[model samples]
Target chain A: MFEIRWHSRAGQGAVTGAKGLAEVVSTTGKFVQAFAFYGSAKRGAAMTAYNRVSDKRIINHEKFMSPEYVLIIDPALIHTADFTANAKENTKYIITSHLNKEDLVKSQPKLEGKEVYVVDCMSIAMDTIGRAIPNTPMLGALMKISGMYEIDFFKESMLNVLRKFPQKIIDANMAAIQRAYDEVN
Target chain B: MAEKIDLLETEVWDGNMAASQAMRQAQIDVVAAYPITPSTPVVENYGNFLANGYIDGEFVMVESEHAAMSGCIGASAAGGRVATATSSQGFALMVETLYQASGMRLPIVLNVVNRALAAPLNVNGDHSDMYLGRDSGWIQLNAYNAQDAYDLNLIAFKVAENHKVRLPVMIHQDGFMTSHTAEGVKTLQDEEAYAFVGDFKPMNAMLDFEKPATYGVQTEEDWHFEHKARQHNDLMTKVYPVMEEVFAEFEKKTGRKFDLVTNHRLDDAEVAIVAMGTTVDTAMMVADQLREKGIKAGVMGMRVIRPFPFAKIAEVLSNVKAVCCMDRSSPGGAPGMLYNEISGALYNSAKRPVVTGYVYGLGGRDMTVEYLKGIFADGLENAKAGKPTTPLQQFIGVRGPKLNFL
Candidate 1:
């Protein structure tokens, strides 16, 4: 079983990212569950979403207590939310941030040994999608680190899921995913 | 009986989306709805289907849930297949018309995403609204997850529209727990689902001009006693058979079997838990863990909350030494609803179990495995001693005070 927790502000589409990843993974005939937790939702309050992927059926519907990977869509939440709550020794982090990995490690020494990759998701979204919606790029960085699916395959599946959106938005999101996939270490 | 559902397509849908899809497949004639959190998406998605031409139906946007049900009553009484969705406060607002719908035998299907009633104003999952509507004369069916949320809506329409059971039905799912959580749901072909639900057979419809009818007539002291007696007794007795027939037909068509009350590993068990909605799944998980430790633990999930399924419940729980009834709604000082109902069901049984009440996870708090284990551990101790370890009724997982009342 693999679990991923997402942290973001209300409008950042962290829930969508988690759902997109779950949808993509489910096409492989794996069991997947995705959900978000919030209270009195507002425009910019902290929110959390979760996804569980496994070869076996998942029976537990509660929030993920031990996530193997934690993805931070809003970098500011790193200081506010406990992004690493119940994180295991080998749990990895994929954080959307302007800072490099070393700078992030310097700021939070607790993240030194565990695999931490920081990508400038906002810059990628600005350069590609013309917006600061960083969820797509975060998923792109996740595609690189997790190897859950081929980057092209993941992008195609995501676009298929986003077919309801306008063509320009789809193209821009695809571009953002590609840029983040190529650039994130 | 062997005809199986061909998985022509599968979609990952939350409970609201799945229920909306079911409504569309049923080819409902009208949907009069007012948006409410956790349940808004069911109606919203149905409206989307209408606009996108997936369904040719009237989507009436109303000012409040009361008006929504009033509109549904208007549409359904006009011989149209109608449905709507609501939760928590919206449901509370609609309570007045719920009795009207059922008393008039309108057969409208309401998708109730269960949520807690509020003063602090929470938008999270619980069974408070579901419990509130228990005596409102609607047939109540509960779903544990998204797939059940989808399937039960279809089943609800069939059972509600049955000639013998022409009462409105409320198909309940835990708000947000099932409504917003996405999981793979195998859908029947639109044609198959429509065939399974069949066509609407309007009974005493207002639109039948040839045969005039009057609905919602006042019943004064002279006739009110018989009117209510017939309605309540017919509901308590006739609904079960119609539900069984519909469930049997559904299983034959789709290979998913449903029972009034579902038991997991109850045979040869000494300790058990009776619960509804999402907690049923949680209790089942804990029961498995208890069995791993060689404890004779079992779970009873109430598939039908109304018509209370007393006989089935008593038959299943008779031999258990200790039973915990998990209620997700605040009892407000009384013994929990499920606890009271289960005790009433077991009142005359040959072997009485030590039934206890547990009010837990109100307002969408997670009923963690650890908390559930604590419950089971306590039940185990009670079973060994042949009595409750704590007070007969206590709230679990709440903060600040450990509220216990007889």
Candidate 2:
């Protein structure tokens, strides 16, 4: 099973982002299970959303200890919690922050070199989405680094996921996902 | 053609094992569950089925109790014989759909491993979960040992699917007592059990592509009262008869006959204790000890609690000089949940015995048959005096003092 963990606070649409990713992954005929767990069980608390992708049925219902990919919507969370404790040597990290690759490495020295992909999801979110919610943009970085899905597929799925939201916000979030997908290189 | 096989020579399994076997035997199309104590074993066993390729179904590992019930509702409405398991707070979380499933009359059968609802939050066996849903239109059946858990579950699906009673059913077994308790139970053969469930052809399948219709219609007293009244009348009257008929039919097929209620040694008894679920075991053992002591004590086990079975409860306890009502539920405004109901049922009777209500084991108090002996002694005390109260109630086994607090 390919486990993808998303780190974000509540009310930041991380649950929506995880479910949206589920919708996209499901389009590829792969069985997908996406859900979230939190400690405080309240809004704005640091929470983890998880996804398990597999060819066969998944029986393990606990939190993922070993993840294939990690999408950090808030780079600040890296220091607050043990985000990479369960990560393997071959793990891919797609981080969303204002800093570039060299500065990010300087900030978190342990993350020096390990298939690391960076995206200015904050600036992208403000420019396109007009808000600080960077989950959609970070998800775009996931598509770029993981290459498990196409950018256009996430774009289409995002349209459906954000259909109930404001129309202007929808267009901007779509643009943010695309921008992150481009900048993750 | 010699297709169907006989039921007697099937494999013997334990109650917990029988529950898992029956879910598979029933060909459950979908299972959505979140892990909770006591109820966790069934889901864990079901997960093993998915891993070992025993059952052909999608299992959704949900985040919380709400999502678990929602997923099952979605699957059931789409014409699948869906099932889910829960206990305690998990059962409390499904309260909304517990009402919806019955209001929609979706014939959803849920297995509740009864647990104590907590303030300090205990995860042990109790009846608080099913008690919270007494008014919710689900047929409630309490199971004693693992064997009753196995037996009631088989009949639950049959009753729920009956056109006359297309309502949700809650088959409750005590959390650690019956759910975790290991005991021998007989499961029907695969081919025979399949023939038993037959095809789960829902009358109002919301997913029938060709024949479209609405279900769970929202209303504001136009036809709502009529629909509700019809539901209640059918559930109390029509369903009772159909329930008996189905049991008879099942006995013909599986060679196992079950009664709605079992009055164990009630005849010529001076006092009887009324209880359900695993407490019945304790009551039975206590009955034996009481007989040795020459107390003339007996046990009455409740099979159904939803339709209340008021008439039956009144009839059985009428002869006994006093009845001790053992309950695991606490009603905030009234006496013990079952106590109030039993008292109301026996209120008009000319020989209304002195009834005592006990609301112990709130969040798992480790109830034993000896406890029943104490309660029966209390009932006998009230009875031998030849004086009964207009309304009598007391929590039999509270911490310090027992009083009619409510």
Candidate 3:
């Protein structure tokens, strides 16, 4: 089993991103679950979403998880949310930030010895998708860090998942994914 | 004929979406709902389907949950297939009409996304609403996941509308845990689903003027007792056979089997956890882990919540040495509902196990695997001690001072 948790504001599309990842993984005939803890929260309130992928049926429904990957779409959540809670020994942190990994570690000394990757998902989404919805860009960074799927295959699968959108919007999201995939380190 | 909405063989759906799609495929005649959180999507999706020309059904925008259920009851009495969805306070508001629908034997299908009733105002999953409706004369079916939510909606209509058992049915799923959680659900095609549910058969319908039957008639002391007795009797005897038949036919069509009680590794186990709703699946996973460490752990889950399935409960737990009855709802100064029901079921049995009660996950508090592990450990201890080593009833996963009540 593999688990991932997302730290983001309620309106930042963390739930959508988690469901999208579950959708892509489900096509591989693996069991996957995507859910978020909604606490009567407003749009800007800090929140969390989760994903579970397993070879067998995924039956655990508890919110607690020893997540293998933690994706923080809202950079400020790194300060507000407990992203390191219930983390595995080798848990990887893929965070959205303006600063590089070293600078981020310096600012938040709690991540001093942790395995961390950084990308400016907000900037990437604003430049490509013309919105601060950093969810897709965060997924792109997750792809690069986890290598769970080939970039092209992941993007193609994402196209099907996002096919309900207008062609122009879909193209912009694809570009946003590619830019974040390339830019994250 | 309504337009058929194509679905993938396996679609990623939350419990709310799955239920709404099932309502659509059943080709219901009317959906009267006032939406609530978590459950809002079930009716919201149904309304969208109505607007998008996928369903040829009337979507009534009622003012409140009371009006929502009244509209369903009115439509059902008038001889049309009717359904709705509600959660928490909405369900509470609909409580009076719930008894009306069941007493009148109007087979209205209700999708209840179970949530906590508020004094503090929460919108998360709990069994408070589900427990509130237990005595309302409805056949309650519990769903553990998105797939069960979908499949049980279809089955609820079949079981509720069976000529021998014309009772309202409520399909309960954990509010945010199941209703908002997205998972891959294997779906039946629209035609296959509709065919399985069949057309709605109305008995003593108000619209059938030639028959001239009266409904909601006032019953005095002379008749009310007999009416209640017959209703209770039919629920106990009539519902089981029809439910078994519907479940068997459903399995023949879909290769998925459903029973009054679902057991996991209990045939040879000494200690067991009996739970309902989503907790059942979680307990099964923990039971498997406990078995790896040779604890002889097992799980029993209630699929049919009312018409309580007492005989099945007694039969399944008869062999286990100790049983934990998990209740996700607050018991209000008493032992939890499941604990009372299971203990009553075993009271007349020849081999009565040590029964323990656990109150957990109130108002959407999380029930972790660690919590369940501790519960099972207690169950094993009780089994070994031949009595409860822990308190008779205790609250799990709650903060502050530990609370243990008898």
Candidate 4:
């Protein structure tokens, strides 16, 4: 089973990102469970969502206590939340950060050993979508790191999910995804 | 909520979304809903469907949960296919009209996302509202996951609208635990689902003015006794049999079988846990782990809570040496509702098992695998000692003092 946990503020689309990923993955005939844990329903409150994928049906409905992959959509969560508290030894991180990998590790040495892929997702979203919603860009970073699906697959699937939006919004999100996919390191 | 999913293919849906699809495919005539946590999406998605011209239905935005059920009653009494959704306090608000819906024999299907009733005010998943509506005369069905949520809603419409069981049905899914969690759900083709539920045949419908019927009439001492007896005794007795037939038909159509009670590792087992909602899946996982360690742990998941499956529960649990009854809702000052019911089910059995009551996961607290293993360990010890080691009823993961009661 591949377990993933996502941390983000309420309006940042982490819940939708997790759900979108689950929907796309299930198309490949894998069993998946995606859920979000919410507190207050305000726009800026920190919240977490989770995903579990397996070749077999998943029966456990509890929260993912130990996740293999951690995706942080809100970079501020790195300092504000214990995003890595339950991570395994080989747990990988796909973080939406403005800081480079060296500066990130220099400031937070605890993140040195793990497979940490950092991207300027907020800047990417701003440059591409003209908005700071980093969820799609972060998902691109995740796809790039995990190789769970081809970047085009995520783009097409996400475009389908966002089909209701205006053409510009859709094009911008697609552009953000492509840039994040190419630039995450 | 309105992103298109290919209805022709199997798709991922949360419990709320799955139930919403059932409502949409069933082609419900009216949905009167008040937005509440964990339950809002069920009706919200329906509203989206209504907006997208995906369904032909009336979406009523009522001011409160009470008004929502009242609107459902109005629409249902008018011989329209009607449904609504709510959780916790919202459900509690509608308690007064719950009896009106069932007693009037209106077959309104209610989707109840089970959440804890508030004093501390929790928005997470629990069974407090489920237990609160236990005596409300609605035929209650519990879903452990997304698939069950989808399947049970379709079955509920069929069973509730049946001539023999013209009663309202409350389909319960653990609030956010199931409602907000997305998983792969096998869906029936819209035509197949509509065909399975058949057409709406409303009996004694208010709209049929040719054969006029009076609803909500006062029943004083003269005829109240017989009405109560028929409503509570005779008709309630018919639900299980009707459900059995419906289950059979659903399995034949969708290839998914449902029982009043679902068992896992129960055969030839010495220790078992009895519970409802999401906890059942967690207990089953723990039971499998216990089996790996050479312990005879089993799980009994109660699918239907009302018209309590007494005989089936007794028969399934009769052989176990120890049984733990998991109640996700708080009892406040009494033993958990499941505990009391299970105790009554086994009260006259030939072989008496050491039954213990455990109140856990109240207000959406997580029922971890570790906690479940500890519960099984305690139950096994109780079986070995032929009695409960701790109090007969106790709270599992609550903070502060270990609260126990007789």
What TM-score is obtained for chain B in each of the predicted models? Answer: 0.97, 0.91, 0.99, 0.97
Worst 10-residue lDDT window for candidate 3 chain B reads B1-10
Which pairs clash inside model 4? none
Model 3, range B39-121, lDDT digits (tens) per residue? 99999999998888899889999999999999999999999899999999999999999999999999999999999999989
State the lDDT of candidate 4 residue by residue for B70-89, as single tens digits: 99999999998999999999
Local distance difference test, per candidate?
0.88, 0.75, 0.93, 0.89
Which candidate tops TM-score? 3
* Candidate 4 Cα misplacement greater than 4 A, ranges: B1-8
Tens-digit lDDT track of model 4 for A1-185 = 98999989999888888888888888889999999888567898888989999998888977747999999888888878788878899999888888999898787767878889899888998898887799888888888889989998888888877878999999998998889999999
Better of 3 and 4 by lDDT: 3
- Name the TM-score of candidate 4: 0.97
lDDT of 1 by residue, B168-258 (tens): 9999999988999998887898878989999999989998999999998998999988988998998889999999999999999888899
Ranked by DockQ, top first? 3, 4, 1, 2
Error of 3 at A156 (Å): 1.1
Clashes of each: 0, 0, 0, 0
Query: Can you give the TM-score per candidate against the true fold?
Result: 0.97, 0.65, 0.99, 0.97
TM-score of chain A of 1: 0.95
- Looking at model 2 chain A, report the run of 10 residues with the lowest lDDT sum: A56-65
